[model samples]
Target chain A: MALISPSGRLRRTPFSDGVEAAGVKAYTVYNRMLLPTVFESVEADYHHLKKAVQIWDVSCERQVELRGPDATQLMQLLTPRPLAKMQVGQCYYVPIVDEAGGMLNDPVAVKLADDRWWISIADSDLLLWVKGVAYGRDLDVTIDEPDVSPLGVQGPLADDLMARVFGETVRDVRFFRFGRFDFQGRSLVVARSGYSKQGGFEIYLEGSDLGMPLWTALMEAGRDLDVRAGCPNLIERIEGGLLSYGNDMTRANTPFECGLDLLCKVGPEANCIGHSALQACAEEGPVQQIRAMEIAGDAVPGCDRLWPLFDDGRQVGHVSSAVWSPDYQTNVAVAMVRKDHWEPGTRLQVQTPVGKRGAVVREGFWA
Target chain B: MALISPSGRLRRTPFSDGVEAAGVKAYTVYNRMLLPTVFESVEADYHHLKKAVQIWDVSCERQVELRGPDATQLMQLLTPRPLAKMQVGQCYYVPIVDEAGGMLNDPVAVKLADDRWWISIADSDLLLWVKGVAYGRDLDVTIDEPDVSPLGVQGPLADDLMARVFGETVRDVRFFRFGRFDFQGRSLVVARSGYSKQGGFEIYLEGSDLGMPLWTALMEAGRDLDVRAGCPNLIERIEGGLLSYGNDMTRANTPFECGLDLLCKVGPEANCIGHSALQACAEEGPVQQIRAMEIAGDAVPGCDRLWPLFDDGRQVGHVSSAVWSPDYQTNVAVAMVRKDHWEPGTRLQVQTPVGKRGAVVREGFWA
Candidate 1:
């Protein structure tokens, strides 16, 4: 069900007809809105992930296309960060919050051009939210899923591996930077970004049937690199401090609490959805902020719900996330505590499902 | 959307509704057949994980309830392992394979009692498969989502943490063992098995309502123990060699080739869906077997895709899953390679998206 794209890369079952995720099974190609896909065994195709780099069919990650005259104006309403200053070919990590200041979703905003943009989302129906916001506003913008799939070339040697497929010049592409490349006579925008902290590149192929061919081409070109099949696992993401939506923060969490305040901008001149509440949250600091902590013992705690932080059995705040960090050799956790108890040196006690343990507050990032 | 369970635990919205998966925000609950609840923020809820022993609301990992006249017969047909002599209370890790001997899914089968079993599954639609296997057979089993949810107490100090909630008797339970305790006048079965290699316990609350009461009671009782919210992540799972369906082996991987032959039964008397195919595979031996390899570098590779395992520019196989083992301070990976190349010390090359890298097959656990 895969074919070569206009760019000569393999793509998903192409959109000569309409396509939709009918259900868990295979996707409906023509007239059907779903496809019954074989998800697990596909690992055989991912054999080139480790020592070598191969492309990923992350097309399942829903893409919200923003185009039209008011596209820029509409985007400004979604993200707390100002998109006015952003130019085409630029991207930024933006946190979209709800009315109560809770995080709606975290998406990567890619400014393809002045009047066109793409918001690659983690999870959450932001398209509906955007549409609702656009109901009364005469923003000349249209949102839809374009017939394109995002491809990632990741690994230790990702840069060199990709340069061979595209060109030697791709080796100089810095982190967070992107460039357009002509491969097989087709235009493709390659960006130096990925889920892993490891450096790599992401190529958005704008055509169907690009999966197998590109996969074959990468295999042929990368036949020398020892690559392995791999997929995103919940275990690695949490250990690496990568936040998952349904698993991490929900609509109840404000960007300020998730340490996303840097992306929130509420200058008097800027207008956007949920800006007032975000501004209020900014003016009035959060009651509790997300802080990382280190457990003193070898006993790594899993998901035990937060108990009031205690010192001499006195209550303070509660913890939110915790895990055994292989990098740190001790248990680490992210907790929401009152500003006073949020200090890095503050000592606290967490009530576990099993028993009590000693803990110290610290920063969130492990790497 | 969170509500109090009858047992006083804070039941997640879906659990409270007595459903395995809550309805998607886009759909009405009454009309939806399978409600796959999209949680708002699991990451934040997981914040308390590292510092304190946290209880996980893993209710999403549903237990396929099988209790019928021919339950034992059907259960045996589902797994590759021999379950003829399996006693009640014992659990077996079964690899469900298809006609080609590729894995369908791997689920933990716990024999609760005579003719009664529970299969805790990964994300898969297997109820129909089991039902089809039972058509016209004298099996009286029910397939439906239960109101129950599985809660886990994981971390280094899990034992001590459990003792606080269930009293010191918690120390008597062995690994993979379970015991019943009376709390809030409701009897609950607590097991010492957990996903983390680190020690911990899991308690299966019979109904959704028990979530909050148990969670609150444990939190209140273990106030001295730092109980935090935590969830599973990717980093440790790969290091521990835990295979995830969508990540490692898929329906395309046979038990023998996946290094899971130990879990398969290949006797003439045995009867399973893919038993014959598996037996022939055992006899002829697999052309490719999954093996662990130690890459010679500090650079952590991602699941970028399969790279070529080469010797002198000739291709052999590629690595499938790899990462920088922070604990071992080495790059490690799991790969499916030709049996000949799997030999220890076989030098190979990986085709990364970036460039070529050298690797030598090594032996033993990286962690």
Candidate 2:
């Protein structure tokens, strides 16, 4: 692959200076901002991330703020996740769909109060859609992308590293919840949730000027914890069955197909934009869905495009992501398979860039 | 400075195979697609482009399709530019805005018929916004992104190179006007407008299968014209004063501030979503507007962020894009200057990453 060049359009994160000083090796563009991908090497970084604490510049997880008297009302109309019962400081993974039940973005809705919330988005400009709907319907709400950036601390030593900076109160924050913690005399929202299956916290850093200071503090404080700059590991994420929005699924997919049925509230009074279509889909069920597959081969190459899966030369599905798992001793892949062919132990052929490879559906992702 | 690793999320263009085969060295993601930034080198490509024809795989310019009984109505609601009189074969540069006179996207709206049109968009997801507005308004319009990718044949020898495969009728396609030209038994929309001062034609290649075939034919036929794979050059565009959506202007800007006053027809009949706020902005006039500035220095570094401009140590505005014009022998730049400092010959200090430099407002961009 070619090296990526710099442009003002592909924005820099708040921790860009720290990331540069740490010597980020590779990056992937998300939400028009830089997200570091590789530090030392993919395999080496993955191993270190599991053993020690690392700070992640996930600033690309842009926040779309909903503020005003009608904020909750507008929020409910955008997703089927039943935000009415969501408590303040609770983070709920919401599936934002269109009128036809197609996913627009799978973001975590951070409920701040009754009339103010933030949607920490994966990718795609969900704000434009929100603004358009708000304007078209004349909703009493303001929609915009705030300057807040999320810096993550992940791994087994995450709590230890965080405690060194924010004190022992940081460890008390429960999973899927956020609390206002004092740092440099200002309160910052620190959520005990991150993208990795490895335990961590994502601090909603508000001020850009404090980005470097906080990063430096974390690095200095965790000097004994083997702290390093890291990003979401592909090998670890696939093992944990973390579905990427544009890759693992797209607008053609519904929440049910992406194994996000737990997030949907399709009962009466759901009042979401895709309520009707999603309700029908939930009842009828998706004909095809995401599954974990194990390929019988050496390490597979990067999944740049969907690799077609065939049952006796007839296309049945496609593999969206794949990587060699050093721990698993096999190639783990994520694929969307047809109804009959999705059962565990079902054999299939994946036409990859290297060549055809034997694959079998797994019961579920590795723990 | 990091290399960009590929994933299924960052999409590949129809001509990606050909681009890679031609030794593409660098890329910059736009609209989640790999856009070739350099083939040999930026300077080498620019020098070659000014003298010979080059093929550009600008598939990142995704198209948002509007089809239904209320398509034209929905189109008019999206942009302040009057579209009632747009001819079927014409392409108009429309400024898509929200209700607050904010620039969402500056795309070329291609009128296919009275009830069908294609919006060739920039970086942001304008489809989601349009869909949200349509569904909210209950307009009888269906919106979606079609698989139409635009390939450019640019430079001085563009006409000669295009005539070999597309025939002499391609020469008759007036500026901003598109016509159906037969290619491999398929009629492709070829428009005589591209993103450069050097004239070119943009072929809206529809099918993914035909991407490489057309690319091969163009390369073979234009061998005498020294045709090579190329991309939008940063230096050439900065010199031409062509505004890049996310770089030079963002949602924070207005069309009038972008010097696109001629495109806005904000009279009472104009039913654009931003009509009222735009009318207000037009009446009040923009406080800061985009201007061409000449920096007194050699080539400046890649503008990864906005460099603040100052007059006697007081911040006045910022330069969004800047580059050394090899032909002009000076640094040409695009900046948003305050009303007071926007006049030609007005001097300012640009706080660049390398160092501070003397700058002066230019009468206009070099032709």
Candidate 3:
């Protein structure tokens, strides 16, 4: 790996000072911002996150705020998910797609009111798409990026640490829900949702000036809980079957191929830009689908590119993400396989960087 | 600087193998692809780029291809510049803006034909914006990214090296005009335009399979000319006043504010998306404009963030790009200055990360 050149173009988040002080070792550029990839080490950080707690500066999950009378209409046009039933203080995982039913971004839409919403995006610049749509159609909505950064608290002890800082009332927040909580006279939207299978809360810090203060307060409050600065661990996410945008999928794949059909409400109630195309896809079914696999090998190298899966000397699928799970003592992988080869216990050969390895399809992911 | 984590998400280009073989020292992510920032050293590469021919893997300058009946109409809608006079083989430097006259990207529009064009973009995902517009307006256009990658050959010896590879007719190619040239029996669009003051040509390689062969051919053909692998140098770009998008300008800036008023044709002949908004800005001149400046200091630190410029105790502007020029023996900078303080020879103080330094507005760039 080579060093990343320093420039204002690769933006720095507000929590960079604390992150640097905590000895972040490696980083990845997400949404043109520096996202920490390692702290102590990949394996050490994975073990620490599972046993204790960690504070993640996920400010790279930028928010695209939509406001005004036509905000709801514009939001519905961007995704196939049904947003009419969504109430205030709810967050829905919406798969944004283009006109041909291709995936654009998989974002979490936070409904603040009838006329205001925030789409917390993945790696791509979803803002340009939304703004272009609104302008081209002459929709009555104001769309822009807001000054909001999400700080994640994850682990088994996440609730305990969050309760101590935000109060015991935080424990009552339901999954995929948020509530306004006051800290230092600033009200913030605290949601009980994160990118990990572990229990956690994501506090949406609205002001840049409050980033360091809140980070320090959390550190001081969780001193006894063995808290540390951490990021989304590769080993844990792969084992849990968490899909990463721009890796597992891109504009070439439809939502149905990614096993996101449940979220695509293509009926009359949900009229979206890709509704007709997705409805046809939902009926015809996808040619390939996502599946969890277990590879029989010592340990695979870092999956920097796609690894081809072969069945009887014929390419049948490809593995997008793979890692050795120390807790499970097996090589866990996420693959997009052909429909015929996606059944459980189907044996195949995965061509890793080192060499070919035997792989078997698993029914479910290891938590 | 920390190491950049390798992943399939941060895309590698077709020329990556050659770039790695040349021992690229650092990289920057542009348009979600790896762009080499250094090979030997910044200063070393800067001097070499001025004297001898160097092959640059500028594949990160992705193309957003627009082809269909509505392609010309769609192109006219995206920028304020008049495309009416543009011939089929010409390339125009277009400053794209949103409805409110904010710069979305500054790319070169390559007119392939009457119904086909390629917007060779900067760092941002300009594809999404184009797709969104076409989809929302129901335009008959097929928008997609083609398998095109540009390899730049730059320096004082560029003509000699290119003539040796493609015959003496290559030396007669006019600036900003592209012609089809055969390389390994494959036709490529070779334009006499590049991102520096030195003379060069950018060959738009249409196929990825020919990337390595072409790269090797160039290297082998120019061995006696001190040919090396290089990239856009920081000091040379600053001295030449080549403003970088996302660093020197963003969506917050309009074309007028970037001193591009001459290109923003808002008369009756042109009807662009930002025409009305830009006309208003033209009637009432910009509050601030881009200017060249000279910092009074030995050398400045790597400009990783905005440096504030103060007049007495009031904030006047900010310097976005700055570097110490080895040839000019002074610190060259590009700054956005307030109208009241943009006059040449106006002295001010710039608050860099290292310390405060005296600065003066320059009449023009060094190159």
Candidate 4:
């Protein structure tokens, strides 16, 4: 691994000072911002994240703000998911697709009001797409990236730590729901959602000026809770089957193929840009689908590139993410396998960087 | 500096193998791709780049291919620059703008044909914007990122080294003009241009399979010319006044503010998306404009964030990029200054991370 060169292009987040002070070891650039990949170590971070509370500077999950009378219409046009039932202060895991029913981005659409919304995006530049569509159609809406950064508190003790800062009322926040809370006289949107399966809260910090102050406040309050600077651990996320957008799926795959069919409300009634194409895909099942697999091996090398999956000399699928799980005592992986070869207990061969390894399709993720 | 975690999301270039084999020391993610930032020390690489020829794996300069009947129309809608006089083989340094006449990206538009073009982009995701426009307006065109990786040969001995590999015709290629050259039975777009004041030719290698082969071929052919693996040197670029997209200008800036007013032909008949808005900006000159500044300092730290510029406690502007030039024996910087403070030789105080430093606006860059 090479050192990441510091530049203005690869942006620094608001929580960079605290992340550095905590001695972040490795980083990955997400949405053109610094995302900490390791603190003590990958395995150490994973263990700590599962056991105690951790603060994640997920400011890289940039928000694309849409504000106007046609905001709801524009939001509906971008995804196949039904937004009519969504109330204010709710976040929907929307699978944004292009006209070909291909995945452009998988973002969380946070509904602020009928005329305002924030699409917290993954890796791709979905802002350009939204702006282009709105401009081309001459829609009565505005699209741009606002100065909103999300600071996450994850793990089993997340609730206790968050309640200490935002009050015990935070405990009542339902899943995928958010509430306006006051911190240091500034109102913030605190949501009961995060990237991990572990219980957590994501505070949508509105201004850059309050970034460090809030970070320090959390650290000071959670001193007895064993709080540490952490990031989304690869081992834990893969085990939880949390799919990474560019890594696990790209524009070539539809939502159905990525096991995101539940999020795609495709039908004649749906007016998404990829509605008709997704309807066609829904009729005929996906050719390849994302599946959890366990590879028979020791610790594998970094899964920097795709590992081809084969069954008896025929390529059937590819493993997108793989990591050694200490708790599960197995090498867990997420693969996109062909329909013919994707079944529980089906044996396959994964071509890892070191050598070939035996792999078996699991019924589900470890966690 | 933190180590960059390797992952498929941070895409590896076709020449990644060659770069790794050459002992790449550091990288900066550009357009979600691994861009080698240092092979040796920054100063060592800078000194070497000024003398001998070097092969640069600038594959991060991704191409957004626009094909079909409405390609020209779609292209015209993205930039304020006049494209009427552009020839088939010509490359134009066009500054792309949004509806409000703000600079989106400054890319080199390659005219392959009337209906076929490639906008070799800078740091941002310009593809989404182009696709959105085409889709919204129902234009008969396609937009996609093609597998065209550019391998640059730069420095004083560039022409000598390139001639040995691609024949003498490469020497005849005029500045900002390209010619179809054959390499290993594959036709490539070889243009006499690069991201440097040093002379060079950028070969638009169309296929990824030929990346390593061509890389080795250049290294083998230029053995006597002291060819090395190199990247866009920070010092050299800043000294040459080569503006970086995200660094020197962003969506908040207009082309006129970046001293690119000559490129903006915002007349009534321009027929561009931002023509009218830019005409208004042209009428009322920019409030703040980019300028070259010389800072009085021993050595400036890595400028990862914007440093605010002050004039006797009143905020005047901000410096975006600053570096201590070993050759020039001064701290060279690129700053955006307000109209009242942008005049040459105007003194200002730059708030660097270390402390306050006196700075003066230069008439031009060092080189």
lDDT of 1 by residue, A32-114 (tens): 11111222222232223334554444554556799988888778877788877787777788887654456767878888888
How does each model score on TM-score?
0.48, 0.99, 0.98, 0.99
List where candidate 4 sits over 4 angstroms from the true fold: none
Model 3's CAPRI class? medium
Task: Please give, for residues A185-211, the per-residue lDDT of candidate 4 as tens digits.
Answer: 999999999999888989999999999
iRMS of candidate 3, Å:
0.8
The deviation in Å at residue A44 for candidate 2 is 1.3
Docking class of 4: high
Candidate 3: fraction of native contacts reproduced: 0.66
* Rank by lDDT (best first): 4, 2, 3, 1
lDDT of 4 by residue, B230-347 (tens): 9999999999999999998999999999999999997768878888889999999999999999999799998888899999999999999999899999999999999999999999
Q: Clashes in model 3: which pairs?
A: none
In the range B1-367, model 2's lDDT, one tens digit per residue, is: 5699889899998899999999999999999999999998898999999999999999999999999999999999899888877899999999998888889999999999999999999989999999999988999988998889999999999999999999998889999999999999999999998988899999999998999999999999999889999999988998888999999899999998998988888877878898999999889989999999999977898898999999999999999999888899999999999999999999999999989999999999887
State residue A188's C-alpha deviation in candidate 3, in Å.
0.9
Candidate 4 residue A97 C-alpha distance from true site, Å:
0.4
Residue B366's lDDT within candidate 4 is: 86
RMSD of 4: 1.0
Measured with C-alpha atoms, the lDDT of residue B280 in candidate 2 is 92
Q: For all the predictions, what are the DockQ values?
A: 0.01, 0.88, 0.79, 0.86
Q: What C-alpha lDDT, on a 0 to 100 scale, does residue B102 get in candidate 2? A: 89
Q: What is the TM-score of chain A alone in each candidate?
A: 0.77, 0.99, 0.98, 0.99
